[model samples]
Target: MRSPQGVCLFSLNFPPEPTGIAPYAGALADGLSKAGFSVTAHVAHPHYPEWIIADDYGQWTRTEERGRTSVRRRLHYVPRTPRGYRRLLSELTFGLRLIFDNWRYPAAIVSITPSLFATALVALRLRLTPNRPPLIIWVQDLYGVGLAEVGEGSSLVQRIVRWIESSTFRAADHVVVIHERFNALVTQELGVAADRVSVIRNWTHLADPPNTTAVQARRQLGWPADVILAVHTGNMGAKQGLENIVDAARLAEARNSSVHFVLVGDGGERKHLESLANGVSHISFVDPLDDHDYHLALSAADVLVVNEKPGVASMAVPSKLTSYFNAQRPIVAATDRAGITAEEIFAADAGLVVPAGDPEALLSAIQSLCADEQAAERYGKNGRQYRDAVLGEPAALAKWSDLIQQKFRDSNQN
Candidate 1:
C-alpha cells in the first residue's frame, strides 16, 4: 500500500558527503519531509568528492530513518580514478542494482541526475509499471553536455549516452533545472517540452561563517598570514580543470609573487593535480573540511576562485559559488567567458571572470584584486547582497515543496 504523501527520491549522492550534488539532494529530501511528505530516498552508500566508500558503511545494503525520511543505501563500485570506462562501470553497477530492486508505488517520484544511467534505468521500469506514478527528474548536471565537454568516450559511446539521457528526461512528467540556461538545453538539445521544465536556483547549504578575522582564521588553519591566500574549494574533477590553478601557482612562484594558492577538497583528479604541483611551494592542498572548518576556510581566503576546463560551458553552475557568495568574499572565475559559470559570477556581481585555461590571466585577476582593497570589498558586499536577495534557502526549499505537492495532487486527480 502506498502512503498518500509518500515520495520516492532517487539520488546517487546524498547527505554526509559534503560537496557536489549530495548536499542539495539531501536538503530536498529533508525539506520534503518537513513539508509533510514521507520521502524514501534510494541513494548510494556515501562516496563522492572522495570516491572511496565511508569507513562505517561496508554492507551491501542498509536502511536508516531520519525523521519522516527513509533512506535506502546500496553499495556500488567506486572507482578511485573516475574516468573513461571505469566511471561508466561504476554508474552501470549502481543502475543495475536500482533496476532490480523491488519498488513500491508512491504518490510521486523524483530522480536526481549525474547518476544519469541509474535514473534512466528506473525511468524505464516506471514506464512499464501499471498506472505508473509521476516521475520528476531534478537535473543538477547534464550528462550529455558533460560527456561532450570531457570527451571521455568515442562518438558511438557519446551517442548511446545521449540517447539514454534524452529518453530518461523525456520519460519524466516534469524536469526541474537549477538554472534557466538548462531549460533551453533540455528543450532544444534534449527534446523535452518547454512546459515540463522549472528553474529553482540552488542555494547555500552551509551555515554562516564564524565571526573571525582573516588573520585569526589563517592562524587557526596554520596558513601564512603575510601572503594573499587565493582559495578554490570543492571537487578537483576533470571539469574543474584544476591544472590551471597549478600553472598559475607556478607562475606566481616564478615571479616571487606574494599570492599563495590553496585547494581544499578531493576528487578523481586530485592526485593528478598534486603531481602537477609537486615542487610548487606557492600551491598547497587541504583535504575536505567539516562544515565549520569549511566555512572558516572560505572566510580566510583573500579571494575565492571558480575554475573550469576551457570547454566546460553549460553542464553545471558550480555549487561552490553559492557558498562563496554566503562567505561574502570576492570571487575570481577562470572559466569559459560565455559559460554559465561566468554568467553567474557576472549576475551576482561578486567577482571577475578570466578566460579559462589561462594561468597568466588568473594570476593577473587575483593580483589586481589584491592591489585594490576597495574594489574587493565592493565585490564581497555585492555577493552577500545577492545571496540574501536571490539565493536564500527558505525561498528555494519552499518552491521545491510547493512543486512536489502540486505534482502529487495532480497525479492523484488523474
Candidate 2:
C-alpha cells in the first residue's frame, strides 16, 4: 500500500556513481525523505562517468533502504563506448526495465534526465494511466540542445530528438530547471508553459575543505610545491572539450612556464585525452578522489578550470562549479564567450573567460592569474560570497519540499 506522503523518483543515476548528476539526484532523494516523504527511487546500477559496472554489483536486480528512502536498482546495458547509438541502446534497455517493473501509486513523481529517453518513456506511461499523479521533470541537461551542440547526428535526427524532448516535457505537471537561462529555452524553444517551470539552482554538495595551506595540501597529495597548479576536475567527456586543456598544457611546456595542469576525474574521453597529452610533461591525470581528497585537491590548486566544447552554450552549467565556488579557488573558464557558463562566471565575478578551443588564450589566462595574486584572491572571494548568498542548501531543499507538498495537496483535492 502506498502511503499518503509517498513520492516516486525516477533517476538513471544515483548514489555510488560519485560524479555528474548522481550526487545531485542522491541529495534530492535524501532531502525529500527528510521533508517527510517516503521516497522510492527507481535507479540503474552504478555505471556512469567511467561507464563500467563494478563486479560486486553484478546482480540483475537489487533493493535496499537508505534512511527513509527505498532504493531499487535495476540492471541495464553498461555501454563501454557510450557514443550516440550505444547510449540510446543503454537508455532503451533501462526504460524497458522501468516500464515492466511494478510501480506504486505515489502522491507525486520526480523524474531526472540525462537518461532523457528513459524519462520520456516513463512520461508516456504516466500519460496513459487514468488519474496519474503529478510529475516534476527535473532538467539536469537539455537533451535536444546537447544533441545540437555536440553535432551528434544530421539535422533531421536533431529535429526528432527535439520533438521527443518537447513531448516529454509537455507531459510533466511541472518542470524544474537548474539555471534561469533554461527558462527561455524550455518555454520558447521546447513549448513548455512558462508557469510550469521553476528555477532551483544546484548547491555545493561537497563538505568544506579541511583547514590547511596550499603547501600542506600539495605535500599530502604528492604534487610539486613550486609550480603554478591549474586543475580541472570532473568528467572528461566530449562536451567537456578537455583536449583544449592538453593543448594549453603543451603550450605551457613549450614556453617553459611554471604552470602544471592536472586533469582529475574519469570519463569516456580520458584515454583520448591521455593520448593527446602523451609526452607532455606539464600535464598529469589523477584518478577520481574521495570526498576529503577531492576537496583537498581543489584547495591545492592555484586556479580551477572549466572547459567546454566550442558552441556548447545552453546545454549545461557544469555541476563542478558549485564545488569550485565552495573551494574558494579562482576559476578560469574556456568556453563560448556568449554562453551560459561565461555569463555565470561573470555574474559571480568568479574567474576569467577565454574563447573555447583556444589553446594560446587559455594558457595566457592561466599565466595572468599566476602573475597577479591579488586579482586571483578577489575572484575566489567573490565566488564564495555568491555561493553563500545564492546557493544555500537548506533554501533550495525547502523549495523542493514545498513544491512536493503543494502537489500532494492538489492531488488529494482532485
Candidate 3:
C-alpha cells in the first residue's frame, strides 16, 4: 500500500456546483490524489451563487470517491434566498456539525474560507487539541469584504466577520493566498506577518483550446457575419455588476455599433439582468454551455469581459480570469484599478481596463477593440503566453504538492 495522505480539506464549495471556487477546489484535491496523497474532502451541499440546494444532490449526507480521494458531502442549511443573516446561519449549522464530528485520524487540516465562520471553528477546535494538526487556511475569497462589495452587510457585521478572520489567520500555521493583492490585504491591512502567506496563482480548466476562428465560431453560434462578438462567461451575480454590461449593450444597440455583447452562465442576478436586457437587440444571454461548446465560444469570440462594480476591490479575483486567459482572447475589464483583476490583466498585458461601473467607458473600450484588430491580437497572444507560463497546470499543481510536502509532510516527520 502507498503512504497514507496526511491531509484533510474542509470547504463549503466543491464540483458539480456550476460556478465559484468549486472547480479550483476539485482540481486541487484531484491533483493531490494523483500525486499519491490519499485525500478526504468534507464537501458541503452545493448552495452557491444560486443559493438553493440543487435538486439532484439528494438527502442529508453521502460519501463518494474521486479517484483515490474520498469525498463526503453533508447536508447543510441553505437559505431560500441569498442574504447575509441566512448565509451566516448556514455556516453556523455546518461549522457546528464539523466541530462535533469525529476525527479518527489526525492530519494537517486544510480549511477554506467562504463560510469563514466554519473555518474559524476548525481553527479554534484544533487549538484545544494537544497534538494539533498543522492548520492551513486557504484564502479563496475574502468574505466580509465581499458582502460589502455587493452592497450587503453593515459596519457591525463587517467588524464581527473581521474579528473571526483575524482569529483564523492567527490560528493557521500558513495562510495560502491565490492572488498577490490578497497577500497585501492580509499583511498590510489585516496585521498578519508577510512571511506567513504563500501565493499560488490559480490553474486553468480550459487548456490547449482547439484553434478556431471568430468568423467560423460566429457562424456556428448562428450570429451575424459582420457584427463583433464580445462574450462574458461564468456567474452572473451581483458582484459582477452585469448591469454595466447590459447598459453598454443598450447604448451600442442605439448607436447601431458593430460590437455585440453576449453573457453566458447562471446566478442569482441573472433573472434581474434578463429583465434589464429585455429590449436590447444587440445584447443576448445564453444558458451555460457544455464543455465543447464553451471552449468553442471562448476561442471564437472577438473579445472576453471581466467587470466589477465600483468600491468593490480586494474581495474577489474573478475565477473567470483563468478561463479568459485560456480562451486566448483579449479582454475588457471594467473594475477598480486597485483591484486584483485590473492588476493581473495589466501585468499580463492581456487586455484593456476601463473605469469601474462606467457603462460609457465600457462601451468605448469595446468599440476601440473592434476598431483596432492589431492591438486586440497582440493582447490575445500575450494572455495565452502568460497563462501557459504562470497559470499552467504543471507549475500550479507542482506548487500545491510542494506546499503539501513542506507544510504537511515535513512537519509530520519532525
Candidate 4:
C-alpha cells in the first residue's frame, strides 16, 4: 500500500553497518512503514567498524524489503585516513550521492546525525524548494566535537563543518536530540530555539526472554565458572577509553584473581589494547560477534562497561546503553558526563556511574557488585523495569510514528 504522505528516511549508514544507529535507522523505517507511512531508506553501502566497504554489498546497488520499508543502498567513497578524516569523507560522499537518488521520492525527511553533510544537504534542498517537505534533524552525536576527538581536519575545515552543521540544525523544521544535555547544546551552542527542538530519548528494541541457560554460552566462550565475568562490548576505539578498562582489569586481577574482563568487538584501538593485555590471562579479547551473540555475551557478563575520555562530556552519547538496558544487567558507566543514561540508571537503581577514565573508580564500582549478589539482582531488575517502561520498541515506535506522520500532514497542508 502506498503511504498517505511520502516520507523518505536518509542515513549515512544503515543495516549491516554493524553499529547502533544503522540498525536503529532500519528498525525505524520498518516501524514507520507498519504505521502506514511509505518509508524508503536511503543509505550508503555498509562500511563501519572495519572502515572499509562490506564485501557482500559489492561496490553499489543493493536493495531489500524490510517489512513494508524499501531500502536503497548506493556506492560512495570510503577514505583511507584510518580515523575521523575518512569518516568525514564517507559522510560527505553519501550525502552528495543521496541528493540525486532521493530527489523524486520522500515528501518529508528525517536524518540521523554526525552525517552533517546529509542533514545539511536535505536542509538545503528544503530551503531551496518552497513547497518541499519539512526536515527533522535527529542529533545523535555532535559532529564538531566528535571530529576533534579523533584528530581530524584542519582548523579551517572544522570551522566550515561546524558552520554547515549549525546551519543544518537551524534549517530543520524540528530538531530532536537524544537527551536533555544534547538538547541544551543545540540551543546554547548552536542557537537553536527551545520551541523548535525536542528531547527524544533513545530506546531499545523489545528484547527476547533472557537465555535461562547460559551453559551453552559459557561453554562456547570458555568463561570460567568461578571467575566474575566483566564484559565490554561495542567499538574498541580511542574515544571509548578502552585502555582504562585494561588498567581496571589489571587492578581487578591484583584485587581478586577470579575477576575476569572480556573485551569484545574491534576498532581503531584494538591492536594497542590487545598488545597491552598480551600476556594477561585474566583479560580476554574476542572477535566482534553478531547481534545475537553480542546479546548472549552481555547476558553472560557479571558487569557491563561504558567509558569515556576525561573531560569529554557532551562529546558523545554511547548507543550501547540501550543494549545494556535491554540486557537488564548492572552497568558501570565511566563517563565524565553521566547525562541521561547514567541519571536514569541511578534513578532506577540499575547501575553505578563513575567519573570517566578513572580506573580506580571503575574498579571500585565493579567490586561493589562482585561482593553483593543482592545488590546486583536489585540493580538488574531496576534496569529491566526502566527498559520496559521507557525504552522498549513499542514506546519508541509510537513516539516516532506520531512525530513522522504529523510532519507528513503538516507538509501536505503546506
Cα-based lDDT at residue 172, candidate 2: 90
Instruction: Give the distance in Å from residue 142's predicted Cα in candidate 2 to where it truly belongs.
Output: 0.6
lDDT of 4 by residue, 249-315 (tens): 8887777657788888777788889899877677998876777777778878888888776655666
Model 3, range 164-252, lDDT digits (tens) per residue?
78778977888888888899888876667888788988888655787678777777877666878889888887788899999999999
Extract clashing residue pairs from model 4: none
Model 2 lDDT-worst window of ten: 1-10
lDDT of 1 at 148: 89
Ranking by lDDT: 2, 1, 3, 4
Question: Candidate 1 lDDT (Cα, whole model)?
Answer: 0.90
Model 2 TM-score relative to the real fold: 0.98
> Candidate 1 vs candidate 4: which has greater lDDT?
1
Per-candidate local distance difference test = 0.90, 0.90, 0.81, 0.76
Q: Model 1 clash tally? A: 0
Least accurate 10 contiguous residues by lDDT in model 4 = 205-214
- Residue 154 error, candidate 4, Å: 6.9
- Which one wins by lDDT: 2 or 3? 2
As for candidate 3, its clashing pairs are none
Error of 2 at 314 (Å): 0.5
